[model samples]
Target: MSDTNENKLYGLVVEFGDSNALVKAAERVRDSGYTHTDAHAPFPVHGLTEALGIRRTILPWIVLGGGLTGCIGGFMLQYWVSVSAYPLNVGGRPLNSWPSFIPVAFECTILLAGLSAMIGMIALNGLPRPHHPVFNAPNFERASGNGFFLVVEADDPQFDLQSTRALLDDLGGAAVSEVYDD
Candidate 1:
């Protein structure tokens, strides 16, 4: 890899077998004055978020905003088409009748919220570009099966190459590897 590619990975990889072990390791790493750490597991591990001190995601807020925008847009479109741009008299009904607009507004809200959730999740996860340094590690294919992995990023102020390795070793990690950015 070129120098530019080498600058991407900045961490240490600690391999584990079980969720319990991974959670314990995460807690240890978090308490070790390290802030940039991530964990990978074959399945969602309960309490893992709490262990990593991860805050609630902002996707809900994004969805809410999108839903609100959709509602307003739908209402405005119906209002403009029925009340302002072209008003039609049907069964002596008045223009700007809100009851008839509810269905469109509701559908738009659902559509926008769903779209926002999908897009927000992808955006927040930094998707599309596929390469990851963890893939370079041997036997990492098992990560999607039964393996559990924890990575403590080197950018953390407390991360020292030697000390971090030593810490992982002391934490009963099955294997520890230095992750390069490039």
Candidate 2:
């Protein structure tokens, strides 16, 4: 494909020789004020997240909210049924027994927490991404193996084909190539 206006530009990808080089390139790209960038490596590379300037996620708070909702809902349901709806008196026991409600409320807490964790992770990470534009890069398949790569997304305000390519080259990146949205 040609680099023409007809082609939707995804971004530019640069393959680094090693983790150190990848980290350096990422730091440079971040320092150059490129906000939309990603680093790919076969395995975890220490300090790469910091180099990319990524912040912490709020998934834990989401799960906590879900769990609290479930617990309250479950307890109220049981309360309404036992104390108000039916009010069954078993063996002279008090109708408003709080102890029995604990088990169901606890179970509800666990269930909703687990469900929220799964859903939150999917939503936060933008899952179900069957394909990405970077897959169009040459030799990108190596990214799952030995390849270490950094991509500067065209969405970034500072992203320019010529200058970004030159910057990647200056960072000692090899096989620096443009990735198209196709």
Candidate 3:
């Protein structure tokens, strides 16, 4: 039987004392061609996302699609109801009065777009996560306070335990440790 106490590694975690160090480390890691890397800080660090080669989120496109769908659906619903289901000739207005449908379409656009933004954000982030393997790293609790961390996952094609540890050490990381999977 395998020893469960022998931790299954998730990644390599390198803690930095400050955001500046973390940012520098991230840049170096990116430059070194390590793609599966992430950095964490107690608060947002300007330029750090770019340093990590992060790309723009797709949530806006998702919301736009939802809004367009809502707009079309809203307009069609009104058209069907007024022109097909109940033909009412009021004030000499046309049965398919597109002008009257604008307000409902606008409202539906806002509603669906707002809902899509919320849902897309939640889904994209993989939220409701109560746990993460990085939490197993030493002093990880400080991440919400003062710690800044950079992790290179074990699954990275370039990942090598010794080499990564050495690289993190060279990058001025403190308390470099192995992050374990549960």
Give the backbone clash total of model 2: 0
Q: Write the per-residue lDDT of candidate 2 for residues 1-182, one digit (tens) a residue.
A: 65668889988899987999999889999999999999999999999999999987899999999999889999999999998999998998888788989999999999999999999999898988989888898889989989999999998998888998888889887878888887
Across 57-86, the per-residue lDDT of candidate 1 in tens digits comes to 999999999999999999899999999899
Task: Sort the candidates on TM-score, descending order.
Answer: 1, 2, 3
Q: Tell me the TM-score of each prediction against the true structure.
A: 0.93, 0.91, 0.90
Scored by lDDT, model 3 comes in at: 0.89
| Count of backbone clashes, every candidate in sequence | 6, 0, 0
lDDT of each: 0.86, 0.90, 0.89
Q: 1-182, model 3: which lDDT tens digit per residue? A: 12348767788899999998889899999998898999878898998999999999999999999999989999999999999998999999889999989999999999999999999999998997889888878888999999999999999899999998888889987878877886
Q: Using lDDT as the measure, which candidate wins?
A: 2
Which portions of model 1 miss their true places by more than 4 Å?
A: 1-9
RMSD list, candidates in order: 2.3, 1.7, 2.3
